[model samples]
Target: MTVQEFIEFKIISFGDYFVTPLHIMQMVILIIVSWTIILISKQVVQRQINSGRFDKGRGKALFQILNYSIIVLTIIAGLDMVGVKITLLLAGSAALLVGVGLGLQQVFNDIVSGILLLFEGTVTVGDIIELNNIVGKVEKISIRTSKIETRDGIVIIVPNSKLVSDNVINWSHNRSVTRFRIKVGVAYGSDVSLVMKLLSDSALEHPEVVRTPEPKARFIDFGESSLDFELLFYSKRMFDIEFVRSDIRVKIDQKFRENNITIPFPQRDLHFKTSDTFSIDKTK
Candidate 1:
């Protein structure tokens, strides 16, 4: 046989569909072309991100959308090249898809949630979020899940649906800075004015604290053992807020010591009552 005839000779058949050397070559070429297109698209998206045309979170979402689109299109094209008609395949598997969909409802929900998160811009990569009392920074967002890195450097995989359905506090959303309060209690007899001044001064002394708004001290409540006070401050270090608070606390303690202010601990006095008949038992 001629080279052309050899290349075209069918090796296997499924119904009317035949697999041939020529067909295999065509499939290989199609895959290469699709991969090249995907790479080019990725490069363009990366350029946009690096150029500051889009913020990191938005850029990441866009890249994910583009990447998924390319993959889906590639799959469709690959099937078509292999002589499988997309419409016919879908029509034949319609019932099977329904059954699978029913079993994978949660999977579909996560995929939908991921799309919503990307489009709505509510939760995105690089955001500091609090969910179910777990506070972490979003590291990656995918079609079904997201990766969050906690303060201890532990990475947790969270379902996209959870992020969407649950109450999530996005600390870094729409603002670069957030307000945090540090609570401190001083002894009841301590000078209130001096305590307030010290709290304010300690916050101001911290480099991360914002200067414009100015930290203010509030006497929030009267406690049982000590006077409850809260120091409100704004800072840009959302992820490192715990450190900022600790530093301020240390400074506050040092200042209080210098000023002879005492932070009192909880104290309670217990009294014993003796009955008339039991009072004489002490002599025994």
Candidate 2:
């Protein structure tokens, strides 16, 4: 048979729909062209993002939208080539779609939340955030979920809906430096001035700590057995802040030991009153 006649030969026929070799060729070509377009577009977008022309997160979001649109269009074109009527297909599946939508309500919610995150630019890549008391850095955000890498180097998948609905603390938002505190209790008789000085000096000595804002020591309150003091300092290293805090604590301990400032433990005094009703058994 001639090539044109072979191309027109139907492979499968069902009522009003049929598939031909021409249709198969068209679908293959469409997929190849669509893939090429997306690959090229992705490279262009990446260059723009790397050049700092726009925010990285927003650029990624824009690319995602474009990519999804292309895939949808490719699907429509493939279906059309295979003699499938898009409108008729949608009309026939309307009821089925409704049922599926109801069952996947939370999935739809997450998709919407992801869109909001991409558009709002509130939560972006590389941001140190605390959600549900689990602190991590945002690595990626997709249509239904986000990838976060915790301090322990563990990657966790979180639903986007939770990100939108929960109270999340974005530490690296707007400001690079975040303030942290370390609490210490000293013996009551320890010189308050000396304690404050030691706390401030220890924080100041750390290279990670910000000096412009200046670390300060606050005499919070007088406890039952010791004087409570808090050392507050700001640092740009939010991801590994625990390490900074540890180093500062080490410094503070060294300073306190050198100055003879004792970190007192909780102490309680008890007085015994001999009474007929509450007598202790001397021999048991």
Candidate 3:
């Protein structure tokens, strides 16, 4: 039943002061208003779920709005039922608002920032996000906070205000490609050109690595007894980035070994001198 109809039925049954015609009119209007709000909220939720246009951020905002609307409508309905004047409450609380404002500034900021984030399309649920050096996929966005699921399968709840104020990295925002640089050090005498070719072919052979960009092999620098070569390549966005990095290292080592590219070992040359007295006597 509509809120108005339900209230009318209750009033007739109760035989209270609300039984009067004026009271009946007010009750019916209040119920209708609340029902209208409920119906609209339902439609909004369904439409958002179907549309799939807004990212998780906007979707979450809409969901929160619907919840808040329903709550406000219920409050208004209850006040009307109990004969409390909302207008008077608004008037009497005018001075108190400033005091409450000072106390709840952070809360207000969170709510406002949550709304702004929804509209700005910064970080959305299902989008991989990196903020404050923590990498995770957004799981949920709420009024006061947001949830993120990291690769280690941990869930983190971060305040909404912090989300807006911090730098957010949306990994999957537009491009699903990620680049990683793997450094390989081979013996100084190793054929640098041959090493480059081997590394390139190894990267290309990997299914996850991109061939169009054509993994690049460049001489980075000279290390202690070895020459360092860097293999830069793009890969299909993998949730397990560390896995990709480790796998690339393993592949590079295997390839260098098979091709005889002399993966160098650290060596430091040392020259030892005789005691100072023996050296001085020999010089004399």
Candidate 4:
């Protein structure tokens, strides 16, 4: 048989739709071309990202969108080449799709939310975020969920809908540095001026602390048994903030001890109204 006759030989048939060697070959070629386009697009996008011509998160998101679009178009073209009526097929599956959509409402919601996240750029990879009291750095964002690596190095997958519908704190969104405060109370009658100076100095001693904003010591209030003071400092380390705070606390403790500034414990005074009541308790 000639090559053209062999290529046109029908391999499968169903109603008006039929698959032939020619159709299969065409699909193979189409897929190869589509894959080449996707690869080239990825390379271009990565180059732009590397060159700082595009934001990494947004660029990746855009590339994924383009890749998926191309694949979908390729599928439609291949089906058409095989004599599959795209419009009729969709019409036939309309009822089934509705049923599936209803059953998978949350899944659909998450998928849509994922698309929103990628488009809006509100939440992205490498951002330090806090949700449901859990703080972590986003490692990946996909169509249905996101992966977050916590401060403890535990990775957690969070549904995209939750990120969109719930309140989230993005520490690295507006700026790199975030201000954190440590509250400490000194023993009553301890030199307030000395306490403030110590708090400021201890925070400044930390290398991670920002110097341009300058560490601040606020004499917040007078507690029942101590003088409350707050030490505020800015740092670029959001994920490791707990360690930074701990280091500052250690420094504050050492400084307070060296300066004889005591952190007083909670104190409560009791008054004895009658000795008779105490004697009754002893008898019982």
Every model's TM-score? 0.89, 0.85, 0.71, 0.91
**Candidate scoring better on TM-score of 1 and 4:** 4
Please, what are the lDDT tens digits per residue for candidate 2 over residues 1-284? 99999999999999988999998889899999999999998999899999989567667877877787899999998998887989999999999999999999999999999988887878888789999888999999998999999999999999999889999999987777899999999998999998999999999999999997999999999999999999999999999899999999999999999999999878999999987787889998
Candidate 4 Cα outliers beyond 4 Å, as residue runs: 275-284
User: Please, what's the RMSD in Å of model 3?
Assistant: 6.3
lDDT per model vs. reference:
0.91, 0.92, 0.76, 0.90
Error of 3 at 118 (Å): 0.9
TM-score ranking, high to low: 4, 1, 2, 3
Per-residue error (Å), model 1, residue 225: 2.6
Q: Report the error of model 2 at residue 184, Å.
A: 1.5
Residues 1-284, candidate 1: write the lDDT tens digits: 99999998988888978888987888788779878887887788779889989778988898788778877987897778669999999999999999999999999999999999988889988999999998999999999999999988999999999999999999999887899999999998899999999999999999999997899999999999999999999999998699999999999999999999999979999999986774556677
The C-alpha local distance difference test score for the whole of candidate 4 amounts to 0.90
Candidate 1 TM-score versus the reference: 0.89
Model with the higher lDDT, candidate 1 or 3: 1
Looking at model 2, report the run of 10 residues with the lowest lDDT sum. Answer: 54-63
Query: Candidate 1, after superposition: displacement of residue 10 in Å?
Result: 3.0
Steric collisions counted per model: 0, 0, 1, 0
